[model samples]
Target: MARIRLTLLVREDWRDRYPAVLERCRQAGLVIERELAAVGAIAGSIDEGQLLALEAIEGISAIEPERLNTGLE
Candidate 1:
């Protein structure tokens, strides 16, 4: 299975329920990278096949796959 990098947007003030969120992500087989707490986001990699499962996890607002972009403002 192809692994893709993804950024997961979560509910506001996500730390209050971080443990639940972490468990959910782990269950989705994601290799967690970093936590952006202030913005309620997480970075990680997971099999492409698991995309839908990840999205279905509670509290996830958006799933944005990594993309290529030149330095354009």
Candidate 2:
């Protein structure tokens, strides 16, 4: 299976919904690869169906790939 990475930007007001969203992700077989709380960013991989499920979450602003690794300057 090809792994696809996605970055989700969650709204501040929806912080309370994080747990539920995570549960949903798990139910859909999506694994959270990484998270950056400071930026409200979540990176994960999921199948096409799971991706569609995630899009249903209300506070999800944007979902895209973590395309760049800018670790060293």
Candidate 3:
């Protein structure tokens, strides 16, 4: 499947283990583009097929498609 950009929300309780969580995300096939440890957010791209794998990770609270603002709004 083609890769799609995504935004992951890290659970508040998992903030302390952000690095490890990030590693797990990488192992799950996320090509990390940006990490906002303070807000517990991670932005990356991953195979559409692997999305479920990422969602299965315990530390991740949510997974959303990356949104693009065309400036028309």
lDDT of 2 by residue, 1-73 (tens): 5667788887887767766656666676668887666667777887765677778777777888657778977
Residue 5 miss distance in model 2 (angstroms): 0.7
Count of clashes, each model: 0, 0, 0
Q: What lDDT is obtained when candidate 1 is compared to the true structure?
A: 0.86
Index of the highest-lDDT prediction? 3
Worst 10 residues of 2 by lDDT: 19-28
Measured against the true structure, the TM-scores of the candidates, in listed sequence, are 0.83, 0.67, 0.91
Q: Give a tens-digit lDDT track for model 1, residues 34-73.
A: 8876678889999999888898898888889999688896
Candidate with the larger lDDT of 2 and 3: 3
Please give the lDDT score at residue 46 for candidate 2. Answer: 79
- Candidate 2 accuracy as lDDT: 0.73
Q: Give the candidate number with the greatest TM-score.
A: 3
* Per-candidate alpha-carbon RMSD to the true structure: 2.1, 3.7, 1.2
The lDDT-based order of candidates, best leading, equals: 3, 1, 2
Q: lDDT values of the candidates?
A: 0.86, 0.73, 0.95
Pull out the clashing pairs in model 2: none
